[model samples]
Target chain A: MKTPTIRDVAQRAKVSLKTVSRVINNEPSVRANTRERVQRAIETLGYLPDLSARSLRSATSYALGVVYDNPNAYYVISVQNGVLSACREQGFGLQIHPCDSSSPRLAEELRDLVRRSRLAGLVVAPPMSERMELVRYLAANKIPFVRILSAAEDPADGYPCVYVDDRDAAYEITEHLIQLGHQRIGFLWGGVSHRSSPERFKGYESALKDYGIPLDKKLVIPGDYSFDDGFRGARRLFALRDRPTAIFGSNDEIAAGVLAAAKSCGIDVPYELSIAGFEDSPFSKQSWPALTTAKQNTEEIARHAALRLIAELRPPGDAIAAAYAKNEGFSPQLVIRDSTARARLPAAD
Target chain B: MKTPTIRDVAQRAKVSLKTVSRVINNEPSVRANTRERVQRAIETLGYLPDLSARSLRSATSYALGVVYDNPNAYYVISVQNGVLSACREQGFGLQIHPCDSSSPRLAEELRDLVRRSRLAGLVVAPPMSERMELVRYLAANKIPFVRILSAAEDPADGYPCVYVDDRDAAYEITEHLIQLGHQRIGFLWGGVSHRSSPERFKGYESALKDYGIPLDKKLVIPGDYSFDDGFRGARRLFALRDRPTAIFGSNDEIAAGVLAAAKSCGIDVPYELSIAGFEDSPFSKQSWPALTTAKQNTEEIARHAALRLIAELRPPGDAIAAAYAKNEGFSPQLVIRDSTARARLPAAD
Candidate 1:
């Protein structure tokens, strides 16, 4: 059987080629009665508009490219779902491209994707946010992109980004612990270079200062976001001469790892050592005692970012001012679970 | 600047468009000198074919569709890796489309994808596996697909498939525990309706018979391959007055849940009771006493299925047979980890 075409639709509808085009493009001048005929013809003929072929007819294709490198399944999946939902509503399709710096021809490869895909917009993820050369290349090429998490402190000057107040979430979490009388806290930070780490650390520091507790540098250790790193870093926390009574891990995987490490070492959780994590991932819930963490609302944030990208690419029929009026910057919510507990006071000698 | 075309290459090479195309397609009988000239012209013009656009012209698209229903991260990720690797090797782009029974207009939706995406082939995963109606629909439509674990008994009867020999693996594992001195054994079962479940149960039953241990109906409990099921099922095991010293869980998540359930109940693992699991997932290795489970080689199987799909889709010019010969079936390897232990003697009367 032959593939159905626009020609087939035109013939089946008993309409001229131009009339069929008008019906497909939803040109307002077409009579409602005639439009229904064309639609019926499309249904009967099972004629799917060759999306890419149709794009070739348009000056700009209705497609956006998403280039990501994040390893967190929940975060990535949420973002993909959000983007797909937005794309579906907008009559567009997303081209999801996952790349790692390990691709030998990384620069050339991304550039090739940009050119070949003929993408109207891009959704960039870390650590591509830190790839200045790639960013500059995209900018130079006049490509519009929305950065999910820019390593830059202030893309404020130029680049548009959907961001979280990581520092604020960290501060709130710390304060929550402080209220529970936890002073000797062990902070496990994500890599020192990422912008979120320093900001989160600052939040932890500020909470301690506000509570009039002297900050101890020895208690703060850098931890990569991996679960193994969590285990190793938590072990270091336990090795301290004045070991922390409470531990805060950078992410859920790390937090779970910390819990596992504590379990292996015979440390009672939320009793001898309270623990907490960030990014309320599936891992957080799956872990024993569950993790007290921050809810980033990743899906919602991703939807907002995708919507913003689509709006930037092709202005919707609605007014930009009205859309802006409805737009609100989001904040990460704190999810308190069983991981954290009241400070265990020293037993009487 | 400007986009380069095949016309630009022909113009640069001072040759006919046909001659340039012959070099591009690597057709036989192109003079070496002419081929070199064409290659040089192409390089100078920077003429990389726009695959989406070209597919419309030649009707040979570099796109494959991945259709699956399950939301399990481990399974999805493994399948994605396999499909993507195969697609990349064939210079194709992959579109991952997840579906379920509840998705309204299933046939129409799939047909719509087939029509719009210009897919060369497809990879389907369960519980979409059990949807024989959809399977027949796809076959009737003349679309090529590789079903992942669809047929338990006959793999090649309907279409090409990559199947796991879970029954055999389950048998050996159960037998291993028996050899370790366990008389009474517990079995945790997943959804019985699944095609794989009955086979796994058969292996367990037959293995026990060979070892002369009477099958204890009281010790077996129904579970799903999930954390909650494991937690609930293990509690039932704990409640039994004459509980088995060793328990076998259906999968890793259930195993983890069993471990968690034990920890919360103050029961020591492997010391007082032993537990085993199937599917050596990342969670298995990361679990407290890493799961002693069957290594499904999910990644390899996925790669194999994908390779098969691509081989089957190979064009007249391509060496389809050789490509298939390169990748045959891969068996699941048994990984003995920390989850299982020697069965302890029952408590003295």
Candidate 2:
């Protein structure tokens, strides 16, 4: 006839109050035997945890926010799926917040989101993750968070992050083209604001240098990551006196544009020119001749980011929490399809 | 510092307590002048509304759940964006819940979700929306919800819904192919469980009947809504002794598959054959030569569903709520692209 409190459950289980709280919260620190005992006591007493009250007491909610500013539907959904998987596993709720990275009021908006929702932590996605100003604001507010970033190495900013090595992936893609005897390899840049653009560019430059190929300014076109940009960039390359034997679009959308441009110009793929794209998006596989791209596991990266953020919300000194706190990295691998082949030899005198 | 209550704000603004609550929830029925007065009073008093306590008293939270079981990344993201837009405008929160419709415990899972999260209502997307058993469960539990479904007419089930006329769209697509001097047209079916498939098939059947063409069972292939289905279906049609001049895929992904199949078999599209697809998705545009398909405004439909769900959660007798309660429908328009053309005249006829 009486409502059972957490204290009652703790007493019945012969465990400390903190252990009951940990069991109720489903934290990994509670031993299996202790967890089972607490569960039995809770069932016997018909005790139900007051989730909101628990959150208020702990100064953190059982929810994680995934903040993203991506236009690509495929990329955004993949991130959502990844974060959702981690949340389901850890018994945490997910709140997906899409924001305008270029907005001046971004920090204020994010702050209000955290305060209003009482979120435990956040999983930040680029290009917001790459913005130091926003990251600094989060740190200053003492908001527990993890970022999914594009970098060759850890920034060592005393922040937990899951980073992707775009530079390394780009380098491998370039090396593949070079090995195929492509001397004039053109590159199309993604949005300048994105850290991926510069990281990928560095990889391209490194590969060119290693292969003893001189870089041509004309071959490098500056444009945002889009199908239209790829189309325009490829057209500019094709109009040159000596067109490049192959072209690399920073992302798949740009590469798709190049493929369309080639068709418009009556150029045969692989036989006349090879094309490579980053990010093995759906279109890359659906594209005619299919595309040769680097398979970047965005879902996996996002899942790791969410896991780390949730771990940070757990009690310190937990082995699982410590493992998740360590910095994580990923490098996309090459996927060869119908888009690339050996370059054609020139006619002799 | 003494915290101000809703009562104090309402008294200061010279408005009813209900009016102040309406303004706080951002309900559209609140008069502009009244809302402004309430807003000023709150700002002057530095009053912060207690969201959690308000939910407990009202028996509903200021959050709506988007329940979907779709594999299409593009479709899912569009739905989320639409729901988010409505939530932002109405000062509500959104929770994206992707459920396994086939799971035996789906009903229990959904019930737990609503109870634990205390959602105000739900915006359901197909094929979950088409499941009568699930719909009955929600209605039985007195849950305020709206469904986005494919139907030619309102089911008038007392519950509100946003429907798309897939049959009409399918009819127009088939008629376009027939008008292009094509006597033989093939059809690919989407998932049988989805209501859209049957609605589309009905349209295709009706067009053939009205055009004085006899139904050929062999020309109608059974498959799910996928690229592989389109590819396999197209191949079967191609292997026929008297192949059809055009093929209608249930959706864009299937149409893309048909295009690829044509390339694999060395068939010249539009000249030797034509292809049509439903749901003019991104791949339809990205495909070689593009695709002639129906443009379904998924975002608009989803936004309308969310609006209806939110309206149902509002207090009864509100004018805005009454307006949103009316059933709405949409017909996808035919978009002509490069994939369809007139059937080539028989040589030496």
Q: List the TM values for chain B, per candidate.
A: 0.91, 0.88
Which ten-residue region of model 2 chain B has the weakest summed lDDT? B50-59
Give residue A344's lDDT in candidate 2 (0 to 100): 90
All candidates' lDDT scores? 0.76, 0.88
For residues B238-262, write the lDDT of model 2, one tens digit per residue: 9999899999999998898898899
**Alpha carbon lDDT at B282, candidate 1:** 70
Candidate 2 has an fnat equal to 0.23
On TM-score, the leading prediction is 1
For A218-299, candidate 1 gives per-residue lDDT tens digits of 9988878778988999999899899898888877877888898998899988778888888887767766777899887877
CAPRI quality level assigned to candidate 1 from its DockQ score: medium
Residue-level error in angstroms, candidate 1, position B28: 2.8
- Native-to-model Cα distance after best TM-score fit, residue A331 in candidate 1, in Å: 2.6
Clashing pairs in 2: none
For residues A200-224, write the lDDT of model 2, one tens digit per residue: 9999999999999999999999999
